[model samples]
Target chain A: MDAYFFPIIVTGAFAGIGIGLLGVFIVGMRMPFIGSCISHTAMVGAVYATLFNINPTLGALVLSMLGSAGVAFIPNNRKNLDANTGQAILLAFMMGLVFLAVGLEQDSRSEMLSLLWGNVLFAGWGTALTTGSLTVALMVFSLLFNKELKAILFSRSLAEATSMYTHLVYFLFLCFCGLILAVNLKAVGGLLIFSLLVCPAAAAYQICHGHKAVVLTSMLFGLLSTVIGFLMSYYLNLPTGACTVLVSTLIFAFTSFSRFVLNMND
Target chain B: MKNCVALSDILIKRGSHTILQIDQLTIHAGEFVGLLGPNGAGKTTFLKLCCGLIKPNRGNVRFQNQCISRIAPGRIAHFRKHIGYIPQQAEYHAHLPFTLREVVAMGRNALKPLFHALDKTDYEIVDSWIDKMGLADRGRQTFRSLSGGQQQKALIARAMVAEPQFLLLDEPGANLDPNWKKQLRETLDRLFNDCRITALLISHELDLIPSACQRLILLDQGRIVQDGPKAQVINSDFARQLFGRTITTPEKP
Candidate 1:
């Protein structure tokens, strides 16, 4: 592989692993919309950052954190505003801001466009390093706090009742999720990143029996999707983000189908 | 006996409508109290207030003489760990992947310090509770796969694994069959008679309350209408009016 190909491949791997692991928790929590909300919020940050001549990644990270914090702190009263409804409102608001920023920009919109439709092939050493560091931090945090995370995922009320520092853990988890999405936005693109966050973990859920099994399987599926997607993009000259999402979707489809076939036989 | 939980001048309102109101209520340590009320009488809300899940709009909920609301937000979890709380129904996503064993193991999470894993002894305690609840064979099964009664039993086991000083159960006997109900009653009796765990159990079905429960508190229209010994409360004209004449006065257990 060429020198440029190495960084591209490495970036894809890190993005795949990070997004995949985060997906299980997001989907398990029944908040799949949160991924979309945070990603779009990051896009708005990146867009505005470009307009103001600031580092788009830093802006994305800060805004995504703020967005996730809003979600985490908002009261989830069903009578007033539920979490999903809150996320939907945030998503709409972010979309509006992104468009406004884009319209205001006087410079070339290539960087902004690249963020919307990611190009992993153009990933440099900086992208690979950032993605790798984030992936490692996420993995470590997940491993170290496995029991607490599981408790929160199982039932936040029960976790709180049991005195498990649930609010702190949940806030930290959301922040990490925001950070990962923001960093990966340039390589994977905001529009299609949610697919990587949902499909691989969801595919693992179709076949895995236990929590640990589901997590490991999801990680493997994520790795497979990104690597295979990268190879396909190289050979077929397709969009990297679209290719990765398609691969992850196919994996999910295959697992769901296999599960159905097995159940039919039984 | 000292007060285990005390609610003074407590008032909980939702948009100007009072859900629960009390001037004074105290549950003594080692007391097995059964809370009886009609639907929307706010028994669940009462339990939530005691455990600091919900703050009262007006007054204080004190546990062991310290005000729960006054406790630092960071230390509230520590206080809650000493009290095991079982909601009427734990709302979790259908796709949550934890097995029954893992769910039960969560009881220990609050007791241990942060970053500390469950040790072998902790697992042993969890396993023992699982066996006690007759879920030994189903430990590895996904929690969602269990029947309603089985799931309730598993949650009970989860609460008991921590060996809490106080237990707050809300309609724990719901969805249980006669056999499982008897088992639950026996478990409560043992916890009261042997373990001396202070408990406040909420149940609509009078028979589901353990025979060991000595005190009964009746609620109606957001107020405490009756508080006395179980037999006295059951035989009161007000309780009879509320429960109807179908409930007959019984010999003391």
Candidate 2:
């Protein structure tokens, strides 16, 4: 049991790094709402999976990929809030279905809540392996595509002009996001997933400018927050998810202020 | 090599705005053309049409008798590989983290990725261009750290390092003080004379245009008001009405 729990803790922290990595892309794209949409859709998929007795993680992957595609193809017109609106509708629908599932289950309300917050203490060995492998794989692929991704971030049309298929890159990035979102499910929970995506990178951007620094600093901040949050949760016997979010928030705010001071000095 | 761009009766409209309405524009290779107009004149729009960055609602832009719209996107990049575009008031943020050298190296990105490690040859070329732009000492400086004129020089260097067959300059002299304007113009004139790069430059400040551009196209209200050889067009009655100045040839008397 201890063996299983220890690796799960390591995996949770590892997946936190993936979230941090994803956060860099989000920040680079200047689209924070993307994470929220992905998380909401992932949760809906989680619900579908639970109802059908399938891997909820796979369910999350399907919905998030769909969500990313939906956003990507949406007409550039402002009215197509389809991405965010889709998230809202999906979030409510999934919550209703999960509540219904909760009612039909023999498990107690607390047990269902445990799944919602993702009790890292009970994360199984299989969960550890799945999340760890996916995170590592995603990170490696992103590194390989860094230049193309950088070109995309700078100017999509220019990237396209240079024979880099900007759309294909975006599609691949979404696929990566979906898979990584699935992996992060155990640590962040589907509901609170976006916090891990936004906080660390946003804070890092407050201090850094270029993609290189942003990627490195954000990942560091993310790993720090995840490790610190888990330690706090372990020592204080408090809720883990809340602790993680709080720590990230504090770090982001602190970094923002420090950057402001540094800018003033310069 | 005689490279030429021909646009016949190119017409374009955006919503209620007629962005570009021209009869015929033939820019031959080894010629620098000045596109002059007031604000809101479709100068940049016309350049965009030629570069295929934006398509005209009517008519088409052609290079060497090949339609720009018909070119595949990948081929369009290859087509654009020979085109240099320096947008107006290019704001360089030092925050982008590219030094003067790296930014100029982006010119060769057609051959490699933006982040791929540059080779010694690439750096050598970058060094040559940096010196050309008088930015040799400032090669290591961040983009935003440079002064306004220096930044403009760097931006031009970045665009020109590719040694494009065609160069487009949009308000290349915009916002620069008179001294800087002259400096910029001298640099541009020197580049055009040396490389014989076919170029279309847009500027509202007609006086800033160098005499080396033998042809001029005047645009206002999104339509070509005047198009002809520089001497003929500048001395015409329309030029007087447009700018409220009597321009005459020295040989006229």
Candidate 3:
């Protein structure tokens, strides 16, 4: 086995579990753009950190956190500036900043682009540590607040009427998504990480009828996609992030097909 | 007896529009009241205030003699557990993954502690409500798969599983066919057999309001136009104007 094989396996586990569970919340709430918004903010932060010679991960983490909270805290009743609108505006602003940061540090231009496409083969133990901790924290939160999450997924207004602080719950959930994206920034890259957060969960949604089933199936799909895609990339000398995203997309297509066939029989 | 819900100088405004303004009102304990109003009459807004989901801009809302806003934020869940709120049926998304049983079980979520699984008693309560609502076979079916009336029945079961002291229904019968509407009326009547549990049902359909509600409260342009016995209020010109026709007695089964 190659010396990098162990790191690859660990990184796969980290990205799979963290993004998979977080995907359930994102998909259940029907907000796919949240993934894009958070990842783009992370990209801008990474570029800025590269220009300043700082740890890119820390900068990415802080900016993405702000972006997530900005989108989540938008009042639900606002017709002009809802969550989706806010996220789109933030994403556009971050994209502009990312380019500016890249241009400012012409010497580090490749370094900034590296964050966009990722180079997971050289991802150090720190990547594993960040992803591992984030996944664990998210799992604990999901366990403790299962009921509240279910209520919110069913209907935010009804949940609030039950005297639950649904707005707080929603904001915290988005923040966790941001944290996960930040932690996985190097392993999957900003552009492809959203695929990891969406495709596996979407495939799971086609086959699972219950909440618990959907979450578990999504994690299973994510892990399988990551491990297989990582292996394919290693043997073929291809990009790990693109391979992983493609695998997830294939899985979603398969599940959709199977669901269609099953429904036809009924 | 103290009022279950009391409002004083209540003003509900959205931007520049003062949607609802109530000088004073009291819902006594153990009374079934029907709220009648036209579109945009702020019936739903009033129910929201009563449930403490929204705070009035310039007044106090007291529940059981204690102001809702004054209670510690953490303790509000305890207060809310005693009230059942069923929003308009249209609020439910058809694609939600909940089954009939799961929907009903949500009623008990507020009473249980966080992270705790449903105990045997919780399941028993959930099952009882499903059965009582005539959804015995539909328990396993997804909420979206059921007919409109069945879905509404499941929602009612969800609200009642808590055995709330106050039940607030917001036009639960809208968008239903005549047959389904009759079934809904019967189901509501059966659920309110105990006079100890007060109820305030909001509806525009005169024929759909359950016969058990003794008092009728009418709202027009956000103010209470009439509040009295059902017979007296139903005969008024305001009632005719609200309904846009001569009011006839609703038929009894």
**Against the true two-chain complex, what DockQ does each candidate achieve?**
0.57, 0.21, 0.46
On residues B47-85, what C-alpha lDDT tens digit does candidate 2 reach at each position?
Answer: 777787776767768876678866666566657767777
- Label model 2 with its docking quality class: incorrect
The numbered model that scores best in lDDT is 1
Ranked candidates (TM-score, high to low): 1, 3, 2
Top-down DockQ ranking: 1, 3, 2
Tens digits of lDDT, candidate 1, A1-266: 66768888888898899999999898888788899999998999898888889999999999999988977887644557777887888888888888788777768587788888887866889889989999999999998888899887877777877874788888899999899999999878888998899999999888887799989889889988998998888889898888999999999999999999888310
The top-ranked prediction according to DockQ is 1
Is model 1 an incorrect, acceptable, medium or high docking prediction? medium
Estimate, for each residue in A62-133, the C-alpha lDDT of model 3 and write its tens digit.
Answer: 988998887786665454666677767877888788878877787878778778876677666776776788
Q: How much is the lDDT of residue B66 in candidate 3?
A: 82
Error of 2 at A173 (Å): 2.7
Can you write out model 2's per-residue Cα lDDT over A184-266, one digit (the tens) per residue?
76566766667878899888867764567778888888888777787787779877777788888999999878977777311
What's each prediction's TM-score? 0.93, 0.80, 0.93
DockQ, candidate 1, vs. native dimer:
0.57
The alpha-carbon interface RMSD of model 2 comes to 4.3
User: Candidate 1: which stretches are off by over 4 Å?
Assistant: A76-78, A264-266, B177-183, B240-245, B248-253
Model 3 earns a TM-score of 0.93
Answer with 1 or 2, whichever has the higher DockQ: 1
